[model samples]
Target: MLGAMSSIKVQCVIKEKNEIGESPVWEEKDSSLVYVDITGQKVSRWSSLTGQLDSIATENLVGSVVPRKGGGYVIAEGTRFSFVDWVKRSFSTVAHLDKEKPNTRFNDGKVDPAGRFFAGTMGLELRPAVVERKQGSLYSLHPDHSVVHHFDQVDISNGLDWSLDHRVFYYIDSLAYKVEAFDYNIQTGGLSNRRVVYKVEEDDGIPDGMCIDAEGKLWVACYNGGRVLRIDPQTGTQLQKVKLPVQKTTSCCFGGKDYSDLYVTSAYKGMDENALPKEPEAGCIFKVTGLGVKGIPPYSYTG
Candidate 1:
């Protein structure tokens, strides 16, 4: 059973030119916040220490990233997979997005507890931004650089997340109203028994990114919904809603030692600027304290 939403208050902590700050992560070592701008092709590392903002090229339209156990990060580019060493400022191509022909780009993804990185792809077209539906696939990247597609024909494969127990997997198909769940097998990196956990209100928004709390409750950012929803995976129950001052909330992650701080990202580029103040915090980062559940430690890539 999941817990109910508390009437606790949360606030936006940082503001930057996100355009589309897709994935916000907490670097456990330095206690800084690192996130990526998909359109900007910028990877930003924010330090609370000196109140300084550092950024570097992700080399391409980077969708999501995670700190590598060895060093630097594993980045998903425009159909290309690579590694980025922040210290040396170098990029390594581990895999190509299209050894055949570029058709998709990486989106939201994360490291599962069992030490494997899971990510999904989205159909991408530059200039005027033509996004196609069902032109995507879900993949698992092993430490050895071996890639496997668990499924294909994904409609805007947006967010890939796992349960704290590493037994359940939740994913979002942006533009599709449904947020789906699957029986996750950590040992084999396999998913089975897929089901729709929540069919979001189309009028409200499309499901973008998601996170699971310590108690197994699911939290999802409704990209165009103006709020984040708390859900129960087993019963498909809506437990609560955390309202945001933005319409294009991209994603959220739990950081801080206690896992009590919720960091969220938003998008300002997609919406009509004429309606900016309608969401005063459109491109800002938000924080929800005293309301988060601990997440599993990011998988370290030892291979």
Candidate 2:
């Protein structure tokens, strides 16, 4: 049995709601948190210091957002990667992938320690009554605006992070219910020697988004599980688990001035009418405090 860890205090920080909230990224430059509402087609920014909230409408389903070193955002919207001037609310295309596969769209993504942007796609099934086929892939956007296809046959690709040493890369394919590790080349953004570092049983819920802390531990969000887990990647042991008030927990990242706060985003996308009442805060952004841990600042996309 998975042991129950101590409970931590969690609260709904943003009550505006999102259909499929994901990809929470902490911006050290503004001391704010930026995230995406995939189903709603918007990117939101929340200030921790002033409680100010802002959002930008996008043309398509936005999967993720990463800070640019040149003062903008690199976003994966639909099948295309683009640069967004948050100040001007303008977007310019960087690259488009899988144009033929309109059924596939980009999902979770993050920037590597070396400043390359990596994102993965998944089969998009709009009809809740029908099941989507697994026909997705992972790609890396280079500094020169080139893209490299890394892996194919991915299903609901989500959650990515690198180790503190920059030698190990971690990823999640939600349908597989496992976290995979790779031998990483920090200089070239290459991955190899894939292995499973952690696995989630059916009862534990599927892993969604994830972030690594300064101490080299992983904090993973549990979609449909109403919780976030802190795991020791080396031992594949559950170090801690935080229970939330709602299911459909999508993604999480360490934010706040000291990077001690764990900000989580949840979804209301697939919930039925019966499930909606029970989870009133389903689509809200949650904050988990008192973890006493710190995280490294997310690297910006230098390109």
Candidate 3:
């Protein structure tokens, strides 16, 4: 659908194993690569300076993690949200997302330009549910322990990123194969002017986690497609792509010194042991080069 299966020049920066590894965010200041093992409920950290990795222990069914206001991190576990001081080993539950519908769990999420956390939920039915059109929604977590549901009934809430200017918000609905956009109100935490910025054709792949570069372009991971696609946000045009040897790419983020080293993670969760040989590379961390755009620095929680 998009192109013939191809390979890009990149290596396994980190070889440690993982399950459903996703949500990678490059911490520019620390020169550390941060990501989450969704199913593991653990947050991982890899230092490029030392090439070592350490994990924070947690049991929140974590979907995403970001640097917190003063120190530590804000984690989204299932539908429960909490703040953790990994350094001190203390954690506090900030809010419960699905008090009414306990079956829903938080998926991909990230911090907005204002340092507020935004996360989304998927339909309870593995299949698209009634919430798909309106109920399954994206939420905003502010510094005050407040919450806001921005959109609803999403089939698969996979990835999200913001434009360099903080004026545009981009998000992916995995099952829909669409990366949608909205005019963002940074101060108000409001999203308007909904638009279809990019739609993946069947051949490309299912959209997973995403990151925005300094140029406002979107780098989207193609889950089953085993690759990533670079798209121009303004025109909804596909400009370039990087193919992975694996079959399921979960997420990606720009890391390394200059933000040129793109780190990616894959998943082997759904595959049966019989199908394991078909995707031996499935759950390994990967890297790529010459990925032109530099990603925006992750926002630190101030609230």
Best by TM-score: 2
Q: Pick the candidate with the highest lDDT.
A: 2
lDDT of 1 by residue, 1-303 (tens): 234246456787787758888877788788788889988898888875665788887768888888788888888777766888898888898877454237678888888876677788878844312476678888877888888778887867776677767788888888777888899988888999998887888775778888877788878888877778888877888877888877788888877777677888988886675888677777888888656356544555544
TM-scores of the candidates in the order shown: 0.91, 0.95, 0.90
Model 3 pairs whose backbones collide: 69-301, 131-153, 132-153, 134-152, 135-153, 136-152, 136-153, 137-151, 143-303
lDDT of 3 by residue, 1-303 (tens): 232223347677767767778778777767888878877768888887898998986775677888886877888877877888777776788988754256667778898878889988775544321234433578889888899888776777878988877888898988788889999999898999998988899798788888877777888889888888889988999988888888788888877766767888887777778878876677878988665556656787676
Off by over 4 Å in 1: 1-7, 99-101, 125-130, 292-296
Q: Is candidate 1 or candidate 2 better by lDDT?
A: 2
Screening candidate 2 with a backbone cut-off below 3 angstroms (N, C-alpha, C), the clashing residue pairs are none
Query: For model 2, how does the per-residue alpha-carbon lDDT over 52-106 read when each residue is reduced to its tens digit?
Result: 9999999999999999999989999899999999989899999888442778888
**For candidate 1, what is the TM-score?**
0.91
Per-model RMSD to reference: 2.6, 2.4, 3.5
Off by over 4 Å in 2: 1-7, 98-100, 126-131
User: In model 3, what lDDT does residue 153 have?
Assistant: 65
The parts of candidate 3 lying over 4 Å away from their true place are: 1-8, 98-100, 124-135
- Report the Cα lDDT for residue 152, model 2: 84
